[model samples]
Target: MYVAVKGGEKAIDAAHAWLAEERRGPEDVAELSVDQIKGQLKLAVNRVMAEGSLYDPDLAALAIKQARGDLIEAIFLIRAYRTTLPRFGGSEPVDTEAMACDRRVSATFKDAPGGQVLGPTFDYTHRLLDFKLAADGEVPSAPERAEAPETKPHIMSFLDREDLIQPEPEGAETPPDLTREPLELPAARPLRLQSLTRGDEGFILGMAYSTQRGYARNHAFVAELRIGACAVEMGIPELGFAIELGEVELTECETVNQFQGSKTEPPQFTRGYGLVFGMCERKAISMALVDRALRWKELGEDNVGAPAQDEEFVLYHADNIQATGFLEHIKLPHYVDFQSELELIRKLRREAMGQVRQEAAE
Candidate 1:
């Protein structure tokens, strides 16, 4: 039956037209350029890129524009586009040691190699509104200075020499790609990290916060947090050598954690690692904390029934796309189900009234 309920096509078309007008705002106002969003609102672009698992700044900017500056929507656009791309070949892992770092800091040591460079951070900035920016929006260029040489050794190398930290086994085993396969519980570290890097920033932040609130608390110290660009390389089987593809901005974090030794082993400091697509230090740090918390079983610690410690729970709910799809589905038509429920409720009420009247007559 052709019912009036199916007449939403015209309404949807009109709604889309209205949305387009609202997105552009008034014609009198200056139209926002994608370059402006990419350059000025760089952090938002970085977040979309990081979560989308793509590295193209231009495309990310375009996605942002199309999404009306909604970060999640932009991420969704990028991710959806990414699925249509043909997989050529995987690149060799980039070396962070050779990274040209812009921002590098460590909390574990007072003085470290490469001398803690604090480049372009809002850590100490006052949160007060800048009236001048609102009025003119003009920003002066920073004073020119000679670029320092990049020679920072990892903080963990010092502890490694002293045999104070747990040593990871060196191997060339290829890790599982979460994107290609169905997620199964008791996930490996690589799968867990994959989920976390592409996870919703707010969700990962909350999970990390839970650890700080004593949910499987692992005393974590930021051993090193670095933001910079590293050259990506890909091996050519024909040439029998690896060639540089390009450089990509990355935020890498290494967290030193307290590990209580089991009956078979000695106590030593553990480690948690986080590496993201772009300059997202907050997400990187949060991923590290959550990563360490989920390492309970491998580290020989009790489960403690913490949310972050549950691999199944963390991996399943970490994806924003999946979460949003399920959540938004509630708005879809449920007329048949609601009607059935209404009829059942009325019938129950009538039956209760009849029972009461019979008891009164008795």
Candidate 2:
């Protein structure tokens, strides 16, 4: 006997309660503070901020805790909170050239204007887990260096001196916001770069890897990568000037890609760029490569129909929040739709059986 079950509301309430309990495990034990999460789980917080398009570490940490350690859920939470926030005004384009960088390096050059500083990185470290960190051990700090100039230089400027790199055009026009509007086909460079900045780390990495594996193999050299904090300024109409709103950490990567000299154009190198929130160098670098690959059409390069070269494919699927939402949404109730499909299949089977019997009698 088939019986209809109806407890959707109660089930939802119970699930929510369980989730809350899981998020704040063992009530007797001390709860995790936002500061502790921000400091201890820094990489996860960085990923959330980068994907969420917000710079607040504390908020990101809180979201992480609330989401029960799901990074994408944390990003979704931050994104939802971001929408309710009242935007006072737009900020002036940050001057990366004037950025006081903590770490800056270039793969294209051995030495540049701002000397290479390989700050804290996991590149050289062995993959083995550190046992000392299990007890929350303290390590000795490195010796401090002399204070550098307030306005540090960019490595790309050195290449521009000899006209080696293409000069970026200066524009005073404001760019469009992707979050406010539905993404359209044939997006501009600004929009594409914006989407890539907050894109899923693994998705971007896979796309970048595809290009390297001959999907659209454009030889790429890391022109420069910089990680540091920069002041954000907002224009105040009352004051008639921009004021420093706050400071945020950023990771920026610029890649010099191979360019085949066309009949009309000279053999000059092109570029791919990535800029993301916080100190996420690997993600930024991967994003830059994919960005360049997607720009093949504008650069007059032949499109090999690579996944990386497809603008619609890359931009639409890059966002982790959107991807995860759609993926997980399949778990939601679809009983009505499933029932309709089942009825149709049963009707088709009955018709087939009747036809077979009639044919056998004939």
Candidate 3:
């Protein structure tokens, strides 16, 4: 019942040629440059870098160009490329306290140490289309500010000192790497956070929104959301000291959520943390909310069967590449299976018709 399709190789080559031509579009239009994409389509590059778990902007921009403006495909390309690279050593955990922040804001406090610098945000921008931009698009430069402070204490430290928030215990045990190892059920906080950080932005956003709509609602207040550059350090075994490994732009979000008190414990605020590779505030915030919601088991909260609270559901379905590959695989040849199904249906129909004919004769 299975028939083999011929000329697949020639068909594929012809299709690829057509695709190359399509990617370039009309010959009159200027082809997109990687640098132009990197500078102008920054948010696309940022999303790719953040989700791909790689911070090379140039490469991300190249992937964007090759993927034809599909950010998820760009992320997939980056991720695939990342797997082939050699691993040196792991960098030290970044010190966000000493981050040279470009943008720092606190919704919990009226006055923060950095004084709420709203640097380069589209939050207040109107949605109106500017026709002038189509003719000659040039963004005006922003007014310069004084040099940022070298160090600023975290807003959570104040609550930490008062024991008002659940204490995060530091452990010497190395956390499990989800990228290296297969994911297991009842994931630890580190694994959960890793999964959430690399998860699809829209899927995580939808899950976070579900939490807000009373599916395991955790009243979350954005304690601090900071976007800035932080120095990464790596210990050199030969040098016997840690050395700086350049800086990376990060968007760190800390959400303070409602608490529950048990017989032995007093009511204290809980924390949801999110740290991403680029200046992606919305993704970071959504990751934080979903992170908090998924901590239901450890926090001694009831399982309200929320999508955000389901670790197996969230972690498995959150990888866009995996989801896309499986979804798109349907377009591939299914003739054999379809033929088998058709044969089965026909046989069943034949049997049913034969029975009807016999009954009529009787």
Pairs with steric clashes in candidate 2: none
Query: Candidate 1, overall lDDT?
Result: 0.89
Model 2: which ten-residue window has the lowest total lDDT?
147-156
**Candidate number with the higher TM-score (1 or 2):** 1
lDDT of 3 by residue, 151-184 (tens): 5679999899999998886854567888889999
Worst 10 residues of 3 by lDDT: 144-153
At residue 89, what lDDT does model 3 achieve? 78
Model 2 per-residue lDDT at 225: 91
Off by over 4 Å in 3: 1-6, 147-150, 263-265
Q: Candidate 2 versus the native: TM-score?
A: 0.94
Residues 164-227 of candidate 2 have per-residue lDDT tens digits of 6656655446887898888898998888988999999999999999998899998889989988
Could you estimate the TM-score for every candidate? 0.95, 0.94, 0.95
Give the residue spans of candidate 2 off by over 4 A: 1-6, 27-29, 147-152, 170-172
Global lDDT scores for all candidate models:
0.89, 0.86, 0.89
